[model samples]
Target: MKGPLFYAKILLFGEYGIIKDSKGLAIPYNSYQGALKMSENPSDVAKKSNQNLLKYYKYLSDLKTDLVHFRLDELKRDIDGGMYFDSSIPQGYGVGSSGALVASIYDKYADDKITVLENLTRDKLLNLKHIFSLMESFFHGKSSGLDPLNSYLSLPILINSKDHVEPTGIPSQKQGKGAVFLLDSEITGETEPMVNIFMNKMKNEGFRRMLNEDFAKYTDACIDDFLHGNVKSLFGNVKNLSKVVLSNFKPMIPMAFHQIWQQGIETNAYYLKLCGSGGGGYILGFTEDYEKAKDLLKNYKLELVYRF
Candidate 1:
């Protein structure tokens, strides 16, 4: 049996800024997706996936919460029946690979799951986020639940604050020259370490001030400008945000890309920011001209996401 598909997610803005109550935006990326299915002939890869699912099943079975319930017996049976998650979403790339898997499991096994077609009031949204956060925490020691929420809902989400989130409408992709793209870092990122660095930095008064005043300010501005389709203003804020990330989030940026990150700010070719924790994974890029950005960033693999 094959369950429904769940898509990957891209956090266009927010990243670390969201933890400090900065506004954030996330959108569904349909190019990569995942689903739960049973295989007649389990290959080594499929067997590994099944083994992992068995571990996840134990985690979910032991999960204690009234927020959601799962048909653990059925999930267990599926795991024993050579079931595996068949997905194309790359893990450790900050594209919500585990989020999609979490979404798929919830869709297929949850007894009273919140269906995506519902009206989704603010409270309902919060409940879903909380449940996803708990479920995804198995993958990451801690989670905000935004990734799984986006994958499950398959809608753009706007975070007004730490406690406030709502379904949002973003400007449709236009056939324009400006675009949002992803540059593969060719290295996996470890979220917990990067987050620990941020938390440790929070102890410094100067870093706290910059995060509150500079990072949050630009992040909020970028989200507002993006939702309002203010391309000119959005890029301006993205440039500033890029600068702030470079100056402050030095450890998150790979050592090799430090100069490249700075060059974007100076050249106006494109602005790059952390896609997620940013130790290494995908670096999000924004360009007023895709062709120009592509040529300038020719050595790396870039995936165009949205157009301005």
Candidate 2:
């Protein structure tokens, strides 16, 4: 028995900004996905996944939350019967691997689950985010729950603040020169360490001020520009956002890519930002021309996400 697939997600804007109640936008990335399955003859990988699920089941059983409840007994029964998560999403790549797992588990085992077909009012979306936050905490020491929520809904979600979230529509994709892409740092990032760094940084008065005055402001503007299909304005705000990230959030970026990140801004060919926590996963890039950006960064691997 196999459950439906859950896709990976990209937090297009508002990475660290959302923690402070700034606006955020997340979209489903269909390039990689995962689902739960019961194998007749399990391989070593499948067995390992089953073992992890066993631990997760225990965690969920002890989890105290009024947002959502799971069918823990049935989940345990399935695990004993050789159930495991068979997935293609890369782990520690900032692309929502654990989130897809969380989403799949909720879909298959949650009692009174919120189906995607339902009317998903604002309150319901908030409830789902709250539930996902609890479930995903087992993986990430702290979680905003946006990744799992995006995977579960399979829709673009606009986060007005921590408590206000709802599904939103992005402008139609165009096969044009301007585009959003991902650069492969080829180094895996651990979410815990990266998040810890951010938390530590948050303790600084200077850092907190910068986050409020600069980071959140630029991120919110970028979200508005993208959703409204304002390409010219979007690129300008992204440029400023890229500069702010490079100057202030240096620790989150991989050491090797610092020069490239700046080069994009200096050259105006592209602008680089944190894809997720950003210690060393994929760096998100925005460019007015994909071909020119590709040529400039020929040494690194690039994957086009959306065209504008």
Candidate 3:
């Protein structure tokens, strides 16, 4: 059986801000996607993925009814029928691999699943977030539910505040040297430990202040600038955001990329930031000149996302 595919998502402008009701934006990145399928035979990865999903399903089943809702029996039946995820998205890469899987299962099995075709009002969106949070908590210890929501909706999600979000439009890309790209670390990174580090660091007043003031400001500006096609302003905010990430999120950066990160800041050729809870995995980069950035960042793999 073939099921719908859900693409991976990227929180381009918001990382930690939207958790505090700050403005944020997310876009669907089609480069990676996952789908549910049933096969008589399965590979090791598929077997492992399905086994993990069973554990997740059990967790969801055990959740208190008052806290969340879903149709668990249908999910069980699908699992019993050899239904498993066949996906190209890499796990531990911060590209919503698990999130897409979770969303696909929920879409297929939940009795009262939110239909993307229905009137997706603000209240509905908020309810989905609450439900998705409970559903996805099986993977990440904590979840905003934004990744799964974006995967489910398959749209660019804009966060105006904690209580408001909707599909958004981005400007058409133009051919140019400038780009937003992903650099592979060729290793997997765990989200829990990185998130733990972030939570621990939040205890520091200085870190909290920077997150609230500088990080939030630049993140918000970048979202606004990108949506409005303010290219000049977007790059300016990206540069500052890159700097803030480099200064405060050292633990998240892969060790080998440290010099390249610094070189970007010093040369203004490119700036890199954690794609998602980086310890390894992929790091996102913004470059005014992709060729130069690629040359300078040679010896590593790069994938272009968008052109400026």
- TM-score per prediction, in order, is 0.98, 0.98, 0.96
Q: What global local distance difference test value does model 3 have?
A: 0.85
Each model's C-alpha lDDT?
0.93, 0.93, 0.85
**What are the clashing pairs of model 1?**
none
Residue 107, model 2, lDDT: 93
Candidate 3: regions farther than 4 A off: 66-68
Ranking of models by lDDT: 2, 1, 3
Candidate 3 lDDT, 1-308, residue by residue in tens: 89999999877877767766788788889999999988789888778777877887889878875634677887788777777888998889988887898788778877667789999999888888777777888888998888899999998899888778888888889998789999999989998888889889989999999999999999989888999978888889998999999889888887787888889999988888778778888898888899999998898899988899
Counted clashes in each candidate structure: 0, 0, 0
Among residues 3 or more apart in sequence or in different chains, the pairs in candidate 3 whose N, CA or C atoms overlap within 3 Å are none
**Residue pairs whose backbone atoms clash in candidate 2:** none
Point out the worst 10-residue segment of candidate 2 by lDDT: 64-73
Tens-digit per-residue lDDT, 72-164, candidate 2: 889999999999999998888888999999999999889999889989888888888989999999999989889999999999999999999
